[model samples]
Target chain A: MQPLVLYVLDLAADGAFERCVRRVEARDAVLSVTDLSATRGDGVFETVVVIDGTPQALEEHLDRFARSAALLDLPEPRRDLWRHAVLTAAADLGALRPRAAIKFVLSRGDEAGDGAGTGWALGFAPSAPPAAPPAPIDVVLLDRGYRHDVAQTSPWLLQGAKTLSYAVNMAALREARRRGAQDVVFVSSDGFVLEGPTSTLIARIDGAYVTPPTDLGILPGTTQADVFAGLRAWGEQVATRRLSVPDLLGADAVWLCSSTRGAAAVRSIDGTPFTVDDALTARLRDHLDARKK
Target chain B: MQPLVLYVLDLAADGAFERCVRRVEARDAVLSVTDLSATRGDGVFETVVVIDGTPQALEEHLDRFARSAALLDLPEPRRDLWRHAVLTAAADLGALRPRAAIKFVLSRGDEAGDGAGTGWALGFAPSAPPAAPPAPIDVVLLDRGYRHDVAQTSPWLLQGAKTLSYAVNMAALREARRRGAQDVVFVSSDGFVLEGPTSTLIARIDGAYVTPPTDLGILPGTTQADVFAGLRAWGEQVATRRLSVPDLLGADAVWLCSSTRGAAAVRSIDGTPFTVDDALTARLRDHLDARKK
Candidate 1:
């Protein structure tokens, strides 16, 4: 049986995680009907990798989580309380270390209803890490229906915040699979490359690391940030810009990276194949693996 | 306590809502955390007004609900079961008749996790009907970040579907409130007047009733449709086209119409006041009120 654990949030308790329990058996009643997260999709969450009992880039993830919560105007999460819960979960699911998925979710509690905000941390046996593609993966480009500058021009769209309002993102992924593609990269209505449905895209161009700027309304990728740090430490150049599809195609090498899937070599974009550079891929992959939290 | 009713889907039972419960109490445990609706906002819902214990434009709402569910690739909702549930709820909460809100929710269920699709119908005592503004209501015009033709060109955006990913809509309303206005009328990035955050904007210009076309990526308004039918019966000219701020400002009258808020007379848009023709407002108001189911 897979190991699953849950912890109810209690910020004021001396042992914040004291209410935590192993709920691998009970499979029901985890959400109330009135929770705004369910009713209005008003919440923020993070899914992190736990490698060998250590959550990778956890502090970075939590920081982004706090930022998202703030944007949603929810109360600031007690990071220490969250930390204790994660640690307790890691200890409980210690055997699955190096591979577990640890999820931290903070929902805008039941406002104008029966409850307050709800936050929880759950851990489970991780699936095996994503494997590299046997061949170049196929991708379809989709329109995200926003200008390249909507993030600056329209804060109401909640760009750069990883809110739970991801129905469109999920639909794009499904559209990808339906078209026999493995992934998708969204472009602005103005044709600037944004980011992947759930991952960040990075292009190695002209001996420099380049990705889309956050001003384009793309999320600031935590994994991308980590990889940039590693690249800079290795004396490689890194930069951000308004990347277009042509720019990505012309790059020396391109990859999609996230917390769980360390580095994925994109095979193709909208059916256009790219030659894989073994040396560049190896270097980036090594750096990403070494930098894991 | 306010009235609340629920129905659960049962594929095994001949009557699909056989296991339904009229739980006007118990405020907890109506959902599972693994539900994609709560997790990813992957779901579709319709909010309908119940008048005299009957749901208004239910068939139209369910048809649109079906279309939205299809866009999300959700399982076809058991409409007969939902109809049964809504009728049951109306019967149970009948005392609140002529003023109740009935909600139909069809979540994409659990994906990449536990559970399956969850469909529920809930009945709640409606909040008091929207009041007549002492003066015409004030509105702030905001940009929706899509072009007028985005709805026709981009299907992946789910532009016309009433999906539960409404965080942006809610945010726009908040922005309007923050700006000291009573409502918001969203304009396309390309400067076409689209629709309100939740209501539809209809204007009277040159003795005709005109609303922005759905080609602008606006939600198809059920209430607007009803009012349009009534306007036609009354021999008033009705049309749909790309509307602009100038078109609205130059109109004889403007009103935001929805099921609960039948006619929200617009006093000012972005601080510019428009004359509210009493004749047009009264005619539309009478139609909106008489058309309720």
Candidate 2:
């Protein structure tokens, strides 16, 4: 296995990347207890998968990163610096394994320090590939306790931004596991189907790939976008729309899409069995793995 | 100003504290990039005020910390060990200043490490006391995006627990500032008054002290509890009930209360003026500062 790689980005007063970015030992403690990232989860992060040394969907990830920062009112991330860091880390880890992931983080800095924010990139390859045959996931629907229009009605609640404050998301996942499921799909209070705790939900309904719209206070799905593009190229229909539980139940197939893990078929939701399309799952995996960018 | 103080708590396999608590320099980096506290905000925390070499409301803070951990499904914090650590840090910090605070944290440990969790205690005194006459705070009522009964209907949302995922709270404070206010009192989606982003709301209504019930998905305020006890001793009425914006607008007086800052009178809500009860504010502060436990 390849050793983990880390780079600490030096940020300027205005939060732009400075010239000196230091490569640090991954085992060293690199964060102060007072850093808002550690103390208050006041940060934003993006994880990009690298296939054969190429960081997949790199620009889209960066665009979403900047968007998240803007939503959180943090400084704009320097794209050039972040790109360099991702590519450098990918190359280092991709040499040891064909598959790797790089996570880049930007925080609101120390509580008592100068105003410059804290930023870092970390790259590592999984110790082993997932189980053979890519087991389908069982998911339970959990209440997210927010209305579908909360992102517009109350921006301070930070519904759409992928901030570091993910404790509730983690708790929901644990709740799913307790109920004999491996994953969760959050439902808004007003009966709209939202995204997964860590992935995007795509349901094939009436012969079209449908995902909940981002305006429903959920993340803009990057992997789902790539999958949609691939589906479009293959002459299949795709869409962004408001999804409800009934719509999901009536779908032909359902899957969760994420960067590193690609797509995983949903075998059951709340114990209602849904047939997994093995051939389609395999095709999507191959498409994702063959990304050149 | 005195230098900061820090202690790293060692944990056993079952997440109980071990005897080898090491005091490290406050400036030293003490957390890994992969600690769940930083990566996912998967943790709980509590802050206790230390006055004149004594930690105030120590047991209550510890109880709340343990309750928060239970909510997050983290291990029960060993009370004896935490008490000792808080006292040790508080003593070190209290020797330098009459008013100081100690924050104790427990995280779900490094993502790649053994299952044992990470824990720390940090003590520091403000460089200077707050402005004389204790300027009252002008607050705006912001939507919390959760219904008042969220804590009952959706425990996985982790509403009442004092978790480290405070980015929304911080953002709400920023929104208050953007709207030309100094602080915020979060209101529920279904028209109920909640707590502040970082403080509890206490209103004097109809000649009685009233606060929202904890069942409304809010933290049970430690300072407010103490103030209630003091008020009871003074032969004043105190009650916990659901509050509304109109209730606040019509209240005789209002205040935001926290452990370290004691209490700050609310001078206004939104743009409407509310006269500050200087005598009551001073009395509450003195009553809080006089705690010996």
Candidate 3:
């Protein structure tokens, strides 16, 4: 399998993308060493699925990307330029791009001096989705160490913003993997169920599908949003609330939703099993598939 | 006046330093776009000072760097190789290398398929420090949103590890700046004094120098450790305690200490002023200077 195919956005001659897409070599100079992304973990990024040669929910991803950049006080991302880069990347992958992930990154440039930021669009097909029925994911509950209201009360926490500082998120996932779990759903220190390291927590409880509110400092789940809309259109009740670990355990069905992975049903958490609701899972999976643009 | 001088450590060909140092251009690929540090912020780093063309406390910094890598479950860094790179970088800086900061970075390589990691040593002199009398800084007290014991109780928190996921720290500094303060002292959610965004906090109280312990998830300050040893040898008492916000505001003096910036006295926190203890600050500053090698 080839490594990441990075397409540099040529912002020369007064910052214009005269050349739209070029393959970035491994040793090529694509980023300044002083980029805050490298130095301070200061950057924002998004990974979207390229479905059948079309980027899925690219505008939403860009919207969220811009929001993240804004939170970091970075200049507004040139959305049209991003759209072009994403489209070129998706198109370059040709017919095999279905289910490929297109990563968009914006870095805080060279902070130690030498002025100019960096942006890139990378396209790569993810390894074939885990053995059909998407294999129910075993998860661990980890503390996020922030209160549910921290995003609202403490703006500096950068809650709800998808910044590049995902070390904690990655650490939590590694911890889960170490404990023989495939995933993790972070619980607030105060005990409210939050979201997954790279996904959003959603579950079927009391005839309604529920997701934790993003006010808890979790990134708003784009796939979850699309799923809720699809479910609502199907005459089903979809809601948001403060959830608990026990609530997840007692739910009829639970799933972690994300842009790339889509609907991954949670079978167990902290090694505790819950009977899988195959019908509910299939319904949500179908709805999620139907929602993809 | 110049950009970051990134000395790449080529680990291919049996982990040998094939190409010792190369001038990494602005657009050069010092890192894979897919490097987890760029993608998921999965990495650890250290910034040590170079005095008279020699990196000070290189061994201590390497020890902490190794500790951080362990906390991240990363492969132990090749310290001898890192030392080679650091020396080459400092020597490359030539006669004016005094007080330059040498940053060492280790990233969890490409997350896609490539398994090799990336390492670099960057040397650059920092901007000139502020004028003498040192214009005591105004600081803001921000909540870090975790109990001080989170490190002890939660192994996955990666507490006290100096990982590159510093977005929160950078944001806190920006928040402080926006609030008309020059720096920040992060307070634990449970009302205990933690540390600063980029430095450790210390205060002069009851004729003893005190700093919040690292068990509180604060990065163990190498400079603080050096200062404590120096002070103890000078017959001054140094202690560790769970301090409160009021402890800082009421102290004879407070300082934010780090390797590069040394010790910067706090004049005010959240608009509350503290009388500067110049005599005490000078004593500690002199001790810190003597300890620097």
- State which candidate has the highest TM-score: 2
For B91-139, candidate 2 gives per-residue lDDT tens digits of 8887777788888999998887787889999987776777756899999
Tens-digit lDDT track of model 1 for B116-166 = 677667776644544553357899999999887877777778887887777
Q: Best by lDDT, which number?
A: 2
Q: What is the lDDT of residue B281 in candidate 3?
A: 70
For candidate 2, what is the DockQ?
A: 0.70
Q: How well does candidate 1 score on lDDT at residue A138?
A: 77
The residue-by-residue lDDT of candidate 3 on B198-290, one tens digit each, is 899988888899999888888888888887887798898999988987777778778888887777888988988877877767776777666
What is the C-alpha DockQ of each candidate? Answer: 0.56, 0.70, 0.61
List the candidates' TM-scores in order: 0.91, 0.97, 0.93
DockQ of 1: 0.56
Which portions of model 2 show Cα errors greater than 4 Å?
A1-3, A13-18, B1-3, B13-18
Give the runs in model 3 whose Cα sits over 4 Å from its true position: A1-4, A10-29, A113-116, A127-129, A279-287, A290-292, B11-28, B127-133, B279-283
**Per-residue lDDT of A79-122 in model 2, one digit per residue for the tens?**
88888888888887778677788889999988877878898888
For model 1, what is the error of residue A160's alpha carbon versus the real structure, in angstroms, after optimal superposition? 0.9
- The recovered share of true contacts, given per candidate in order, is 0.72, 0.87, 0.68
